[model samples]
Target: MTRNSLAARALPPAVLVQIPATSKANAHIDPGSGSFFVQMSLVGLLYAGVAIKPYWRRTKAFLTGRRSTPEADDESSDS
Candidate 1:
């Protein structure tokens, strides 16, 4: 095709449209959750203590020259 024919088929100029403003009823601002976050952190610390309790017991036993007895050792199970 010729340049003249290509120029004739070019796209039209873009038209600008006005945007509508948002209404107050559609907008909502949330109050942040502070207590829930504190509770979560406390729960995390509790979980960590629970998870480390066995290792702490083993370390204490080793330091005190006492054997972590099978009866007291919850980390292992033997038949």
Candidate 2:
């Protein structure tokens, strides 16, 4: 058999892609819904964590040896 024929046999069959559900024009938003509240809470927490990550990293660096502490003057005064 040829190399091209061997390579073609090794490949798997093509898969069918599934389409997701689309929102209809008549969809309504209920304020007392549980799913909406859960989704909003998760999104809010995700955004908050992403926004504060840089500040958290800076604070962690100060706690570790990676960055200098602002209390250096206090330590010097104590000694």
Candidate 3:
């Protein structure tokens, strides 16, 4: 067998055993953190999409040599 396959075979059992062994360890995270991170991630994604949209369209048009239509901003209409 190859080195990667042998190594992969070796690591999974250690990972599996270590997790349950640490289950009773004291760890605290505020419940708000999960929701805050979720909201921030969603907002960041939306903001990124909004920010990148024009650049994406411009790059697509440039690479594909297609002119964007004035009436239809995106490819939502039936051609």
Candidate 4:
């Protein structure tokens, strides 16, 4: 008769109904496995690009004589 007991009695059923498998479905295309590989490759490429971006920028700046820091080589004639 308590609120807690009434709440406990309002629980839904736990049995889950599943759809039966079909025989005519294509067995060659495993979408889950393909999607997993694709996701992993994309994540790897994303991390690689992120890891190399700073190095690429620094190399580019150094090669082009573009000082990246405040105490870097002075290019102006303000002696």
Q: Which stretches of candidate 1 lie over 4 Å from their true place?
A: 1-32, 69-79
The alpha-carbon RMSD values of the candidates against the true structure, listed in the order shown, are 27.0, 20.5, 15.8, 22.2
| TM-score sort, best first | 3, 1, 4, 2
- Among the numbered candidates, top lDDT falls to 3
Which residue pairs does candidate 1 place in steric collision? none
Using TM-score as the measure, name the better of candidate 1 and candidate 4: 1
Lowest summed-lDDT stretch of 10 residues in model 2?
70-79
Task: Give a tens-digit lDDT track for model 3, residues 1-79.
Answer: 2343333334543342334443544658555768856765654444444445545677777899997553323322111
Tens digits of per-residue lDDT, candidate 1, 8-50, equal 2232211111234376444376534786466556544444444
lDDT of each: 0.47, 0.43, 0.48, 0.45
List ranges where model 3 is wrong by over 4 Å: 1-32, 70-79
Off by over 4 Å in 4: 1-32, 69-79
Among all windows of 10 consecutive residues in model 1, the one with the lowest summed lDDT is: 9-18
Residues 1-79 of candidate 4: C-alpha lDDT, one tens digit per residue: 2343233234322211123546766668766978866765654444444444445656868899985653231222112
For model 3, state the Cα shift of residue 74 in Å.
6.9
lDDT of 4 at 72: 30
Higher-lDDT candidate of 1 and 2: 1
TM-score of 2: 0.41
